[model samples]
Target: PFFLYLPHTAVHLPLVPGKNFKGSSKGGAYGDWVQEIDWSMGELFKAIKAEGIDEHTLVLFTSDNGSAREKQGSNLPLRGRKGRTDEGGMRVPCIVRWPGRVPAGSSSRALTCTMDLLPTVAAISGGKVSKTPLIDGKNIWPILSGKSKDHPREAFFYYQMDQLQAIRSGDWKLFVAMDSKKRNWGNPEGKKALALYNLAKDIHEDNNLAAENPGIVKQLLAHAENAREDLGDVGRPGKGQRKAGWVKKASPRLLSR
Candidate 1:
């Protein structure tokens, strides 16, 4: 009957662990913060159980991006770190829990993004999303509920800030040519014009198959163009892009004397 979105600031910058959890973890401060987060989730679930909403509540646990390179976090097996467009930066784990709705102890290799959350939640709640601006997300309830095996998304475009960095369709991921300045620590040298990788075989993105699969490269490039037209790239405003919210007057809050 109600929707709750809880965004945690823990396990992030500053790495300030609570006094109780300060020395509880062996991985130092980072591990201590992680332990605190685990405890926070446990408290949340305990409250849900107390309210008798555990059966109907759908909880989604995910991160916005990979671990920070400066911190004692690792995105091992995947190529890049937080700011880059590599799998490490773009890829994140999503865990969904809905008692009988979602399968238990099961995993999905399907390609999905945070953008899909909007439509998926809309579908679950029998709500409607605006079509005027045209949302990019797709309903992935079937996929999550294990009712469908097909990937609802045809392609997912990767963007670094305003720049269109890469595109992934199925197992093939193509990193478009970018300036060295735009490159992050993971992609220090910047990517070639069409550096491709088959994620199915090379999850680390070590092998560049662009030279061998020219046809696939061309296909993905077309998808990139479509994304650019719809979502926009640097310097190019997309037709579908809506105006961002702005405030004409702003003032900082001050305590009353």
Candidate 2:
């Protein structure tokens, strides 16, 4: 576990460097900060090579969450920023390098996520999952091994501040922002609704397809029920009605029908 996750403040704080990496990245205050993180990887990898533990190890690297625009950091092309229910906040980058066990110089669009990390680790280490609550994770060993080209997860979900309940099923994603896009205030709309997108064609989620494809919408909705419980973000449970109030009581209008 070449795992390195520390609260790189300044992006979240007042003024404080670790006194180690004074100047690193190309950016500036924030650039030095982010680059220190990247540079730490270089250092850790160097240590691994020196110890000769790298070949037998699987080094996985990823950001804790998203970057802060308040600090001049950029997610670029991804809408919204950190601490929001938007893609920019939730979307993250990950890289796993295992010399012999994992294929080199290839990429797999496995639709994997942080939620699946536990099961993946369990699978790799031959360990047991604690059966803990809100474990909506599955082992992505096959996908990572380049065996299956298709993603094991039928849907990818987003729960912002435990308020918004969103799901990306196949190419289409449905966002249920509890807070109104209208920004009318009032403890944020504890409502039920959805925003759809075909991620295959529109990874940016610039379009909505809920009205166009009701069948997929329904399937994902049902999936949302289980996912919510398994994910259980913000101390919110999965039972009862959806938190979003926009699309309440509306069944999907399948294109097949």
Candidate 3:
């Protein structure tokens, strides 16, 4: 009956750890911070066991994005960093555990996003999400329950700001611009070059197959176009862009300092 959302503020900027853990880790400060995060999770699990509800709780652990380049975090065997549409930027680790309900130590390679959390939680609580406005998330409860072996998600669209940069369908990923190397967080410009890779074979995205797979490229392009129709891209403006309701701000009053 209780829902506790814990958002930890570790492994981020101003990365300082307690004195006891400062020089204990091999990777220096960031490693110490990571150690603290692990210890914190262990303590949380201990507390849950103490409450005698460990088997009844569903625990999901994940990060918002991939490792940051400046944080000494490694996203090895994957291309690009945080702020890019590459696998290393979009793909993140996800772990879910429910003692009796979910199978222990089972892993799925299915594509899932943080947006899916809203619908997943709603499905678990037997609540209905609003249909007046469209929701981009799909119910992944079936996958979590092991009732379904396949994921409902078929495609993933990558974007920087309002620009659509890449699309992944099946094991194939296509990037419209090959120039997302540097992290320009707010830049609206997308690279003009095109690139493609089969993630199953090239998780590092070292090989470009766009030239050999024209049919696949066309199919993934259609997926990107479909997304643009609903959520118009800044790089290529479309007619289907939804406008946000304007919020009026209060007028500023002049006061003597």
Candidate of highest TM-score: 1
lDDT of each: 0.87, 0.68, 0.82
State the RMSD for candidate 3.
Answer: 3.9
Candidate 1's C-alpha runs over 4 A off are 179-191, 254-257
TM-score of each: 0.92, 0.75, 0.88
Candidate 2 lDDT over residue span 147-249, tens digit each: 7778777777766545436877666678753434322123454554577777667766678778888888788878777776654644567563344558758
**lDDT winner, 1 or 3:** 1
Indicate whether candidate 1 or candidate 2 has the larger lDDT: 1
Clashes of 2: 8
Candidate numbers sorted by lDDT from highest down:
1, 3, 2
lDDT of 3 by residue, 102-148 (tens): 87777777777889998899989989889857678888878888887
lDDT per residue for candidate 1 within 141-200, as digits (tens), equals: 999999887778888888876788899999999988766426544445644566999999
Which residue pairs collide in model 2, if any? Answer: 171-199, 191-244, 191-245, 192-244, 192-245, 192-246, 192-247, 193-247
Relative to the unseen true structure, what is the C-alpha lDDT of residue 9 in candidate 2, on a scale of 0 to 100? 51
